[model samples]
Target: VQAGQRLLIEGAAGNVGRKLIQLATAAGVTVVTTSSARDFDQCQRLGSQACYDYQSGFGDQLVRDEWTFDHVIDTSGRVALATNLDLLLLGGEVTLITAPKDDQFTFGVRAFYMAQKRINGFVISHATVDQLARAAEVLNQAFSAGQLLDDQVSQQHFSDAPRCHQWLEDGQDGHQRFVLLPD
Candidate 1:
């Protein structure tokens, strides 16, 4: 159990972020997430102890004021990778699902060396079938327990996939999730 472990999940409004939030909460871990201000309430409802808008300021002060997390998961590479490092307690672990590039990567490496931090790189596609099956079980339990949000999934016919993508690009569906329906 990851209970009592603090976790910082960046990009908490995205697909992985939303699922991560539910899983973390169900595990009794305290979660702190970052997203747009408009999604603050949603993130909070998803069980985040604190939610910050990544666009505002550097968010360094907020992170510093909050207790350092046991784990930091970066889903958005655009955010400050160095700051995320500073937010970890000694011996804490950081996992980058979407690794930053160029200067960002350079800085993160340097920080890891200097801080003696444990950094792990992750790719969701690399998850084993057994691992995914376990995650699915967790999700199923959460859904049954009413801990997961049922995001609206608008189904468009297979031929309408392009239109669905266009709608997503245009932000016409707000925060609703979408999927294609078999005709």
Candidate 2:
């Protein structure tokens, strides 16, 4: 929430990305978010100072002079590492939740050194008890404030879990999140 700090969040429409936007905005950081063209309006409404369509050749539109971020969070993991590094100012930080080339040791090592960037790798399983408690508290606050009320969850009986997996694998759900219900 440092004044005048520009935070660019990649994958700004998904769950983690959306939460990042809300928290950063609440803390008074100037936030820019990237998503598909269809999700731009949603991201903007959720408190992004600006929303860019990542699929629309907008990455090239962000020249060094036009946009420089103090922090970049790559939630999508689809963007090129070089491009993300170019967007950061000196001594800036970059975080990635996913590494597409994890299996290739040489490529991963080269990519890290080439960026001249401090790269952080993350996995949800790394959340500690304290972190989980804090997340729960935030969710409670959001619910109390009516900001967490949305019909974004689709309930499926346990028997349909296999179908749900198939749907996800087939990319049929889009923004839908499925929840399983025990019969």
What local distance difference test score does each model get? Answer: 0.80, 0.78
TM-score of predicted structure 2: 0.79
lDDT of 1 by residue, 37-124 (tens): 8888988988899888878753565655766888888888776666777787767888888867534343456656776778788887
Clashes of 1: 0
**Residue 93 alpha-carbon offset, candidate 1, angstroms:** 1.4
Off by over 4 Å in 2: 1-3, 101-117, 128-139, 148-151
For 7-88, candidate 2 gives per-residue lDDT tens digits of: 8999988888888887788768889988887888888888897788888665677672388788889898777766777787
Error of 1 at 160 (Å): 2.8
> CA RMSD for every model?
2.5, 3.7
- Candidate 2 lDDT (Cα, 0 to 1): 0.78
